[model samples]
Target: MRLFNTNTARAGVAVIRAGSLDRSDELDVPVHAWVKRKQPWLVLPKDAEMFEDASTMEVLFKLFAR
Candidate 1:
């Protein structure tokens, strides 16, 4: 097994602080479906620009910034 070092852990914290990573499982299909069922009025943004594999830092920033 492997373990993370201080710098590695710090880097991860920095990324979270910068809002570059999505820690919530909100975008997960099952979770999304459940939330939608619970709150039918709630809506999620949809766009042709949606992608499966990659996204820009600005997108990630907007998504995780809260």
Candidate 2:
């Protein structure tokens, strides 16, 4: 299995820290649904702008609506 080193892991953490929402923030499912594409799990900004880091589960749920 591929392993993530500290630097990469920390980078992911930085993304979350830069996000606009908190753990308790309720996300709008339909809005997220609009962004989920067949080829990609979720759509990003025009440039695939970095979002404040979210958990894998959080990101997946938003994309898949599970």
Candidate 3:
């Protein structure tokens, strides 16, 4: 998440939170939203795509290759 924020700060690129849209792990915790609340500048893409339970690299490529 910090990576996203840092890159956005320096490069002005859109932030895409790939993988599970729930932003939580198997533990059912609200991880992404929690981080967003803490770092309000961490912008989430309006078209953030949710992926099935799969490899993160797959999701990342899917997101970036657009």
Candidate 4:
């Protein structure tokens, strides 16, 4: 999942993988609430490895800048 914190040219992106999370993961309640609120704007790709390459991430960043 890619969570974009902003929709403007200087948007910040965070990448989260399903495998990287577990039930025991300790995320703050407010932060989790924020993520839930931002869920609609998140990019959830079917293929988890799609953005594993640096080039792909760079391309996405450039696209966001535009």
**Among these predicted structures, which one has the highest lDDT?**
4
Candidate 3 achieves a global lDDT of 0.40
- Lowest lDDT sum, 10 consecutive residues, model 1, at 29-38
Clashes of each: 0, 5, 0, 0
Cα deviation at 35, candidate 1, in Å, is 22
What tens digits encode model 3's per-residue C-alpha lDDT throughout 1-66? 332332433354444454434543333221233332344575544555433232244454454576
Q: Write the per-residue lDDT of candidate 2 for residues 1-66, one digit (tens) a residue.
A: 222223464343332221344642454332222233234565544544233432354564454555
Against the true structure, whose TM-score is highest?
1
**What tens-digit string does per-residue lDDT give for candidate 1 at 22-62?**
55444442112123233457455553345443345555455
**Where does model 4 exceed 4 Å of error?**
1-11, 22-52, 57-66
Off by over 4 Å in 3: 1-55
lDDT of 4 by residue, 1-66 (tens): 532334344346654543456753464221122233344677643433332323244555554576
lDDT of each: 0.38, 0.38, 0.40, 0.41
Using lDDT as the measure, what is the rank order of every candidate, best first? 4, 3, 1, 2
Using lDDT as the measure, name the better of candidate 3 and candidate 4.
4
Global lDDT for candidate 2? 0.38
Each candidate structure's TM-score, on Cα atoms with residue i matched to residue i, is 0.26, 0.19, 0.22, 0.20
Taking all chains together, the TM-score of candidate 3 against the true structure is 0.22
Model 1 ranges off by over 4 Å? 1-49
